[model samples]
Target: MGTLVSLGSFCLVRFAVRLLLLMFRGAEASTFTFVNKCGQTVWPGILSNAGSPALESTGFELPAASSRAFQPPTGWSGRFWARTGCSAAASGGAWSCATGDCGSGQVECNGAGAAPPATLAEFTLAPSSAGQDFYDVSLVDGYNLPMVVEASGTPGAGGSCAATGCVVDLNRMCPAELRVAEGGACRSACEAFGTPEFCCSGAYASPATCRPSTYSQMFKSACPKSYSYAFDDPTSTFTCAGGADYTITFCPGSAPSQKSSRDSSTSSTTTASSTYSGTGGGLTLEDDSWLASLATGDASHATTARGPVPFLYSFIAAMALAYTLLQ
Candidate 1:
């Protein structure tokens, strides 16, 4: 009789522990950290996708050499960009920015998206902790500044989980036809010409119809891991094990030791096809590994194998304890 009671108690305890573990894993929230390394202040803007809840802030000022962090609920999908050359309204005037303006007329974008010719870091976080998160830096809209997105603290298995972005300053070498008149941003061929080929619209909507143009090639050559055009998916889109925190940095290659200083000219462009390199803030571009996987079209083996190993160990230990109590 005593043995039966001990066995029942142990089973109940083990079941309760397993339930708690599952709940704890599902409740994990991902954190996004934004770092600004530019010489000038950058106003970062956020726009959540439809049906997704709003983040803590829609827009805020991030001074040079500063950083801020935000925690969004699970299953968040949104895009982030920086607005430069912003100005506060005078008297009855409206607040505005020279580039990547959301047209909200104030610091907070209030759920508005950034205008074209702005560098954008887009994300679609997984609905659950065990799923995969998709992210990419897109020049399909255009390029306004250099940015890099790095993921950390993600599960070690499934998905490449590599760092990606356009770290080079394309503004200095932007084609004359594509350069913004004020010279702060570079317009996409689509934004400039509005043709079916460049815009990938009309008959060129599908990947089979649309193809990369000279302009898109230039962007691709400079930033191979970033989305050079609307159809750029295979090499541009990156995935990581879910529950990973990301850091998006502006002016990633502008450190003192780098080719360009924030205050000086950023004419020298660093190509992503180069060897895996580390920029400022201890972040490295995992280009080689990602490219190798891209070449073989086997991204499944990119990440180290990791799963609920800790949980399994705990469960085994609990089972042993339960057996001893039953004995």
Candidate 2:
């Protein structure tokens, strides 16, 4: 009986420790805050990678000057875009959106993807290689609203973080042939023409053959850090340490003032980050604070969330005591 009790206690202890570690393992989740400064209501949609589970809400209404936060599990790779001029039918039917419409019609995307002429914010969080989040604002699908993505808790002279986006409104300046005037969005030349050259497909597939066209150049000139075309990866994507949180703003050039609340100590600080401006189209190495956070691969939140840990520990203790008493 004594030996049985000892063995049981040892197993329980191991199980308890494993449970606790498992709870803390999720601390590295990244929070993305979406802010609507577009002077109108916008329905933001989220799409996770095919194999990854979707985040809490697939879509939600974000009023002007308002914001919402989403916590995605580590290694979540996805894209976010805004839907405009949307309306749902009172009876059970489809939803219709003027621009960036994800076909499902209702507010929630329900796995539906945004249509072309919609600005996009793409991210690969906690990537396998270096554990840094790679993100960018893309006009490759075309442009709807001005947008910016800023990283917090970064280090350096310019804050060691790079903020990237197409903050310029390309709708008004869009070439007449490519303008979707009713929706106030600009369609990409490829979306408008669907040509092999504009789409960067077939013979134009390779980067060597797929050079930026006149239309793509216009987008590149306005938003240098954005993926103006399909082959814009070399200059568009950016990285930050895994612990950093990101803020994506619509109409960023005229973004309104707003406050943010941090839920975890391991999360990035809400310090004011400088706007990133590319001069001479050069790049620099960011600091190591983010690197250190990424190096561990298991770096998690400083403040633990309220979970089943306490109850689990109590149960384990009670079970161990009962076993000892029987012995």
Candidate 3:
């Protein structure tokens, strides 16, 4: 009788453990971590495997689990404007970033020829320019497609810009843009090769001037000064390489590419990085592995180890004691 009770207790305990495991399910998909070269996290623009990459949208979905994956050109250029300080009623959207104001902000949308502030997300296969006046770089449109990251300027209080007129700096705190001076001046960037200016009502902020052509032939002559990541040689900037488009995704400690400092005169690829920052805070991504480990895979042997089954043993002992007394 004693031996039978012991054996039954052991088997019952094992069954209970197995049942618990089945009820909880073993692991999950959160354990994996993926990186997108496209520079954006919402995958629809660059990572979606099913949608037409040539279309534009806010985000995308991954075809499968991947790590360090660049944003595949889905079509959206990964560019959107957040109205800066405008009430929803006034800006008509979240922020009037397209207009440059937050509330009651307005932009002087001149005729069809008015200039708009464009975010340089990627370059497409296009011809180069000879000067800084006008230039073009094919861009990756949403739907993972092609478009142009054109550059031009205007001379008005604020043409079609969100709030009158101003150029919003995208390259902030990254080692890249920091290589130049700050504030109302054409300190660094592809514009310096020409006349570092801001796109205000009549001239670029740096006193250089703005036009609506989109291409800056200024680099070839100014290539000696500052080169466009799209027009320059390979490894020009983080998102300026020649072949594929880059979508941006923000993650913790994931901003290794934020460095923008390089020596233009030396032409030496290896140069110290000058810290520069503009606005979109450094990329901070969530830990995917945390989710993945919980979804699948076997637990470590140490984890599977069974602790003393005190409750089970106690119950068995009680049963035995009752039997002895009754007998």
lDDT of 1 at 200: 89
Q: For residues 80-110, what per-residue lDDT tens digits would candidate 2 score against the true structure?
A: 9988777766586677777889887678888
- Writing each residue's lDDT as its tens digit, candidate 1 over 172-199 gives 6788999883667899999999999999
Instruction: List candidate 3 stretches off by more than 4 Å.
Output: 1-53, 56-95, 98-119, 123-230, 237-247, 255-327
Between candidates 2 and 3, the one scoring higher on TM-score is: 2
TM-score attained by model 2: 0.71
Clashes of each: 0, 3, 127
**What's model 1's lDDT at 282?**
24
- Report the error of model 3 at residue 210, Å: 18
TM-score of each: 0.73, 0.71, 0.23
In model 2, the clashing pairs are: 27-301, 95-105, 266-302
Per-candidate Cα lDDT values, in order, are: 0.74, 0.67, 0.24
Sorting all predicted structures by lDDT, with the top scorer first, yields 1, 2, 3
